[model samples]
Target chain A: MLIHELLPLVGDAQSVVEVSQSGDALRELLRAPAASAYRAYVPDGEKMDAGTVVVAFLGPKPEAHIDAETVAPALRELPVGGRALLLLGWPVPELPYHRLLDELVTAGLQVLQVVPLDKVSRHGAHCAVLAARVDRLAPLRTHLSDAPLDLAGEAPDLRALLRLTGEYVFGDLLSRPLRRNLAAAGDRIKEQDERIRALEKEIAARDATIAKAESRLARARNDLADLRASTTFRIGNTVVQGARRPTRGIVSVPVGLVRIWRKRGTPGERPGPQS
Target chain B: MTLLTDAEASKYWNERHQQETDLRSGGDISFDEATNYMFYLRRLTMLMDRVGLQNNPVAPLYLLDAGCGKGYFSRELAKFGHQVDGIDGSEAAIAHCRELGGGPRYHRTTLSGWRTPWLYDVVFTVDVLFHILDDAEWERSTRNLASLVRLGGKLIVGDWGEDGDHVYGNYQVVRGRDRYLPLLDACGMRFDGWEPYRFRRSPIGLYTFTRIG
Candidate 1:
């Protein structure tokens, strides 16, 4: 399954240079078209033909550091425009592919495809990475894009490439103005929140005033209710009404006045035991 | 059918609030005070995630609390670093909001008549719109709230997501998606999604829209 993915990148290359940990599986796959020259991985400082396809099947194992350094010797043999197919063993998800991709980017390789080989993926072989060295950069598809799986390499769909490019650019364009608007909107909201806080304080002050006025009115109402319920005030008011009517004033007014004088001060205040 | 007028609806809420507890006046009647608050907070948290405010946003957002009965959502949103303006028609509700201070600004205005000089990043009404039994007033309030959303902003309304309208007692008129989608489409509001309250047997949920143009 690893060879199924690697053979397309190695299609009819002038020569094949493989630094393989997966044994002769890839060599067998390349034997069909029979590349003009085939050999083991090149030694350090040994350069290969510019168009040679380098296949590094560095399988995974516990504690193995599969990084750019692991693939640097093979990359040194690759000239500009030369492509590389790396079958990396991903031990755990903690070791993300982005870390390896970062290494490859530093090593002057552009990762064109990263395909996870579920069917024939060996114990440590997590995925297949097809990459090429380029002289200049093109508008990148997202850092992690799995949509371009057209590995046939027979007729590259220029239209689909343009469409993906357009979509990414358009989305970026939309977000630019939106981010600007959101920033401006955020400033306005901050101002408005400050205003809201100020208004809340104003409302709170007004509420305090209203509450104070309400408590005063409640106290006044209680005092009025108590006065209306008092016997002396009720009787005095009756006597006054009777005096205003006509003949009842003589006894009503004098008796009410004498009773009030005897009672003195507050009607409910009992005279201290004649002390 | 003879439904309660908007003024009568306001009066009914005022009278109800005079006797009902605060949570009962504003939230699900079936829930106790603590449950209601927790339920409301959970929903609000999820809503914050949807509107990109769960992380204490980069900038404060302008928010409108349409028909903010008792201003529960408005105050909670303010706590999330957003500026909120709460508008309601009930004299008692606005008085309560004003009494519970230090958050959103309170306005004693009907949902159909609440107009602000600037647009908002979010305009939301939670379980408050169905209480508008008058069809005309309900339409007016929906349109007015939609008009207040700026481009790329959201308008979230709490109601049903079914095809037909339903009525509950003499107070609530739950309008379905049939009545909402067309009007919002005409207003250039794109329907985002709808999710249910999912608390219990209740069918009401939130309908979200965004103004794209």
Candidate 2:
């Protein structure tokens, strides 16, 4: 058995040669005979006429390093019944390994097995391997006829079996405990909802306070404007003070009794004012 | 001091001033002094407000007055919380600007020789560049103007448009708005905006350019 590894250094060597530059390390890695078993980088998809078993060592970091654009294009070029081995450097916790295996099977690939490679030297870097044989490329071509549930023809029976099992096992042994757990979860959810409502109310109150302050500021400005208009104060230039013009003429008095007449008139005026 | 020995430029400016003085002193002007002064003051205040001078009370702004003949605009800008430096090649004009208590630092220099130790936020050259006699001087003057503006700063220019050149009183020169764009582009300057201004009943155009990388 010949084991081969296609280690790409610079350009993507899949369906199309997307990158223009080729690194020296990739050239050295491709010198071995087993490497000759795989097709080299080619730009056109139709030109990939070699390679039976295609093993794609996606990269050192599966999710972070591997280019999905390159991989998806490569997948389209694979021949039927040909094997494709995808080694992912990171394990997906959300996607169960069995479900991924089942998806590959549903996609017309017979999944031989998925293994967590612990003993392999390359496995020093965390990795998962999926070995699959392409059975039919168009498994999902006929949805009604070729669907997984339709092919099984026993999904209804399976659901009935599960219902019966739940009724017997859970009702007999663990019904009360399960109900208690569910009630506790419900109480936690209600507490969270109350906290959310309190936050909403607090935000509304803050907005109202802000609006009131803004209105008060506007009123204060209007009052200041009115005060400025009422106050008619001018600074600088002091000509408009208590300065009066002199009366035009003085009255003529008799020569002999001029002083007497002046005194008498002043005295008479004073007396008249008193009366 | 870098003075222009060009006889045409000197004669042109002298004739221009004579014409302006003649016009201003010719009529029995019935302008309300108090109202006019108040209006000018309000306009200065508004300009200061728009430029955000109030926010920066401690540090003074640096302004460049290009083609600053007698430094009227330069002095006004300095009064509004800016430290101004004005350059005009005409020696008599610079002397008159000094006598007017225009506190802005004045220099008797042509646009070609104008240099500064510091960059300015705004370079204001009003009714000046149109006096350039030829294309070479215009290009040189424009490049010098753009060089004075710091990154993200403005260059404000007011001049006679190409259409208004024939309506000259003392000095004669003409330029259009479209002519300035290519010259400014060569100097790594981009057009920001423009406004139409009429001074002493004569139509003038104002353009602004921002220095960009």
Candidate 3:
């Protein structure tokens, strides 16, 4: 499908800029949706408005030039909250999404969502609409999420340490600014660790209090049960219940007899004096 | 297009197709991304599991995606070293499938009219046969799909896995267990009970069948 046909389907965007090496797909993508300011061009480090929705239609080899070359640069320039829609056209059937996802992440973009648009787009390429928002860390850190060097344990080898330093830390780009950011990240991690410890201590204290409360509740329940079972308590409960059947009958008998005598004497007329 | 005689269904789907949104995730359905993702992932995993259980003699199983609207399942299966042929009635859907030029060969034809030179080891239809509209057409379509399955091959169908069939939105008919079990039996296929699709809000299920004859 042409870009214009596909863009509107993507929903209303403030502005859209598509970067593609190929002319035909770009032309189709640019076909008349005059409503939004949608523009298509070959990737050159042209200054795009920060929040402009940048769609990278990487035709065939998405993992190669398009991802590293085109998308990475554009993503760096994207403003915070700006979205990059990466369309990997039916390149290789076996292309795992993780690779493209990692590439997007390395460029400082956080993947918000992924939608399969293979059926809707005219090119019928295995298309994935990877919506990623530019993040704070996008400008500084420069490698994909998956690292070759294992950062788990101590790396004694000098070569391995160098590789780790190069990949993880600023080795080539060990500029003052990157170093500052790394130090800041380290400080933040330390702060988080302290906070986590405090939280754990607080949770432990809360658990102890809960346990104490539960014990008290259990004791109270047992005491109530014992009180209920006591002879005095049982007698008091019965007395509190007042008149049951037999007792009620004893009170009612005399009153019942009096009423009967009164009713028998009266009969049809009100009884005069002794009559 | 004419074979899709149910005007309401045709119109509904045609508009859906024109909407240019992902059917698996974004559509008229109120399913959020997470639910839809889980549903798709679970369905795909189940399909793979079902195929694995077969232990087919063919190294790369010859599969048919009956009523492959946008060729999602077809392409996914193709990734797993399967030769797939995707067929759909809609011209636009078929056009998109062809344009996307994955390994799966796509054809624009209804299930009833579809014919192949050779039988497939696995012929499955996902969320398609239930929308056949006419009862006779549904029967004919089932028979046609069954006819394409080789002996000892499997046919996995998607629809309502309930006891009795039900209609939804005046177009989709959830062909329950009663309707399909007998239909498969008539086609000389063994009824391998229905399995509920995981993470699906609606009772969408996978109806499994194996051609014994």
- Best of the candidates, DockQ: 1
Best by lDDT: 1
Show where candidate 3 strays beyond 4 Å: A1-275, B1-7, B24-28, B32-34, B53-59
Tens-digit lDDT track for model 3 on A3-45?
3334543344567676655545653544525565666643555
Q: For this target, which candidate reaches the highest TM-score against the unseen true structure?
A: 1
TM-score of each: 0.45, 0.37, 0.41
Scored against the true structure, residue B101 in model 3 reaches a CA lDDT of: 75
- Candidate order by DockQ, decreasing, is 1, 3, 2
Model 2, runs deviating above 4 Å? A1-275, B1-5, B14-57, B160-170, B198-201
Q: i-RMS values of the candidates, in order?
A: 14.4, 36.5, 22.7
* Fnat of each prediction, in sequence: 0.00, 0.00, 0.00
Query: Candidate 2's residue-wise lDDT over A163-213, tens digit each?
Result: 335435645565577668889998999999999999999999999999999
Error of model 3, residue A30, in angstroms: 58
lDDT agreement with native, every candidate: 0.70, 0.50, 0.64
Q: What digit string (tens of lDDT, one per residue) describes model 2 on residues B1-213?
A: 233435866765655544443222111123344443443344344344324332112335677888777666677887766788988877767777788865798888888779764667678776677667556776788788887875545787766554323324333355666777777876656687665543235455567776553
Candidate 2: residue B171 Cα off by (Å): 2.2
Error of 2 at A119 (Å): 74
